[model samples]
Target: PRFKSKKATRQGFKTDRAKIIKGKLRLDKPHGIKNWYDIRMSGDKLLTGELKVVSICRENGKYWASLPFEIEVANKAKTNRVTAVDVNVGHINYTEGKINTLPDNLKRSYKRIKHYQRMLARKSVINGKRATKSNNYVKTRAKLQRDYRKVANIQHDIMQKFTTQLVEEYDKIVIEDLQVKQMQMTHVAPKGLQRSMFGYFRQILSYKCDWNGKKLILADKYYPSTQRCSKCGHIKTGADKVGLNGNLKHGTKHNEYICYECGSVMDRDENAVYNLLALIN
Candidate 1:
C-alpha cells in the first residue's frame, strides 16, 4: 500500500437512529463499532427537527461531522438602521461616519511562522552524502505545518466573531465589490498586506445574513464612489487646464477626499461609504 494500512482518507457510513441526550450525539448499533456510542456536543447549536442524516468526516488533521435537519424560519421585521462598509488597503470605512482598521491576527505571528518554515525546508532535502533524512527532519516539518494550522485557526475565529457581530446589530449591510483576487495577482501592494482574508469574511457574511434574515448589497466595482461628492451631485475629473475650475483634489497622504464642487473634505473611506448607502435608500 502507498500509505499506512491502518489509515484511510475517508469512510461512508449511515445510521437511521441517533439522538442528543445529556448534551451528546448518540448512535445506536453502528456496524463494526461500539453500541450506543456518543460524542460530546460543544460549541454547537442543536438544529431543530428530526435528525435525518449524520455524516462524519476528517479534514486537515481534524474530525468534523455534518448534521442536516429541516427547520422553518419566519421573516424578520425591517429596521431603519443601515450600514455601508468600504474595504481599503489598511483599514475599512463604514457608514455612521467611522473608520476601522482591518484586523489581522496572522500578522502578529508571521516571524514565528517563517522561522519554522525555514527549519522545515533546510532539513527536508537529502544531502550529497546522506541518502535519507534524519528524524529531526520529520519533526521540523511537523512543526512548520502546525504553525500554519495555528494561523488558519486564528483567522477563522476572528472572522466568525466579526461577522456575527455585524449580523446581530445591523439589518441592512452594504459593502464595495472589491477585486481582491486581482489585487493579489498584480502585486501592486505588499505581499502580506494584499493577502487579506476579505473573501472569507464576505463568505461568512453571506450565510450568516441569510440565517439571521438580513440584507447584504455589493456595489458595482466601477461606480466612481471616491470621485463623486456625497453631499452634492458633482463628479471629480482631471483638470482641463492648470487653473481650471471644478478640478478634483485630494490630500497628499490619500487619507481624505475633497469635493470639487461642494468643497467638502472628509475621510476617503467615509465618503465611499455614503456613496454606497445612497444606492438603496
Candidate 2:
C-alpha cells in the first residue's frame, strides 16, 4: 500500500482473495478489507473454475497480477495426432520437415537491439576520469535496456504461441534434446538464427504439455535422426557424401540424407523429423 515510504523503487503485494465475485475481489473478513479489488482482465482464455493463487508483481514500472486457475475441461490435445518438431536457425520444421523462416517482425527486433547496443557503446565513451553519468547517458542506457527487453519479450511471445499450437494440436510431441550450450561453445552455426530459440521452445513445450495433459518425448542427444534413413533404416556415413570436407555439414543443404537402402533423398530436417517420430512408434 505505502510503497514510497522509503527509497523503494518498485513494490507489489498479493492478497488471498477467496470471494472473487465477478470482477470484484474480496479478501477474508479478518483482514479488514472494506473495499474489494476491482480488477478487470481481458484475454482469449476465459477465467473459470477456482483461483489457486494471485501473485502481484511490479516490472519496468508496471504492476501486474498472475492468476493461476484450475478448470474442468475435456481432452485438449487430439489423441490421434502426433508430430515431431525440428528446431533450426532459419525456421521451425514440423511434421514432414518443412521449414518456416523467422517472421520479419522478430528480425526487426534483433536489428533494433543492435542499434541500441551501438548507441549504448557510444554513450559509454563519454565516461572518463572526470566523466560521470550524464542525463543523456542514463536516458541512452534505459533505451538500450528497453530494446534488450523487447527482443527477449518478442522471442518468448513467438515461441509461446508456436509451442502452444504444437501441444494442443498433437497428442504426442517429440523433439531432440539438443546440446545447445555445447553447440554454442563449439561455434556451430555461428551466423544462423534461432540458436538461442531452441531452449526457449523446449522449455515452453515441456510444461505446456503437462498442463494440457499432452505427451512430450525427448529424443536422445546422440540420436542420429538426420543421418538415419526414415524409410529403410539406412545409416549414412560421412564418406558417403560427395565433396564433403570432413564429416557431413549439418544444418545445410549438404546435410541431405540420401538413404542407401531405399534411395530416398530428402531434406535433412524432414528426414530427421521422421526418424524422431519413429522412436516412439
Candidate 3:
C-alpha cells in the first residue's frame, strides 16, 4: 500500500529478511545503510500478483515508489443523473438543465493575492538598484512566494470540493473542452486565469467518475456555450445585447458577463455557468 525507498531496501540487502506480511513486502528491521534501495532488477522471471511494486519515480524533488494492486471492480448499475458544468472567471455554474452557481471563496483570496503580487513587484523594482541579496529583498520575495502558494492551495481545495460534489451527485457530466492554451497566447485574460482550470477539473472528474462507475462527456471546444441563448436556442450574433460587447455595455467588469436574451444579469462567471447548464439538456 506504500512505497519504500530503493536505497533503504538495498542497504540492508536482506533477501532472507523479506517477509510478505499483510500482502506487502516488509523488512524485519531497518538496514543501517543508504543507497541500497536504488537497485532494480529486470527479467522475465518477475513475479506477477495482485500486489506488486510497479515502478519508482523521482518527481518534484522527491522520490516515489509506485505499487499496482488489483482489486475487484465494483458492479453498480449505471445512473441517469446528468449535469453540465461551466468554468468561468469568477464562479462555477452547474445544472441538470437548471441554473445553480457554486459559491467560490477562492476568488476573494485570488484578489488579495493579486494585490500582494503587485505590491511585491513594485517593491522589488524600487529596491533592485540597492542589492540582490538584501534582507529586505529576500523577505519580500519570500512573502510573495508564500502568498502565491496560499492562493494556489485555496484554488486546489475549492476545485477538489466542487468537483467531488459534482461527481458524487451526477452520473454523466458534460463540460466544454475550452481552448485555454490558445486563449493564453492571445493574452485575452489574466495569465493565471488562462492557465486552464478546466484541465484540473477534468482530471479530478475523470478518475472520480471511473471509480464511481459514471460517465463524463466533453462537448466541442468551439461550441457556442456563450453566444447561444439557452432558453430559446437563438444563435446570438454580434454584441448588440447578447455577446461580450453587450455585456460590457451593461456595466459588467472584466471577467464578468450578463445575458440580455433572458434578462438574467449575473456575474459573468454565473452567466457562463447558466449557459453550460443549457447545453446539457
Work out the TM-score per prediction. Answer: 0.69, 0.72, 0.58
RMSD of each: 6.0, 5.2, 9.3
* lDDT per residue (tens digit) for residues 67-145 in model 3: 5656665734555677777775445667633322223454565576677667667766887766445776556555655
What is the per-residue lDDT of model 1 for residues 40-120, given as tens digits with 9 covering 90 to 100? 887766546767777665434455677777676664555657888776664556665443334455665566778867665
Error of 1 at 156 (Å): 2.8
Score residue 86 of candidate 1 by CA lDDT.
74
Instruction: Write down the lDDT of every candidate, Cα atoms only.
Output: 0.65, 0.69, 0.58
lDDT of 2 by residue, 127-241 (tens): 6532225766556556665666676776777778778778777888999999877666655565453434777778888988888889999999988887788888877666664
Best by lDDT: 2
Model 2 residue runs over 4 Å out of place are 1-65, 70-73, 96-101, 128-132, 190-196, 239-255, 259-263
The candidate, 1 or 2, that scores higher on lDDT is 2
Model 3 CA deviation exceeding 4 Å by range: 1-79, 96-130, 248-281
TM-score of 1: 0.69
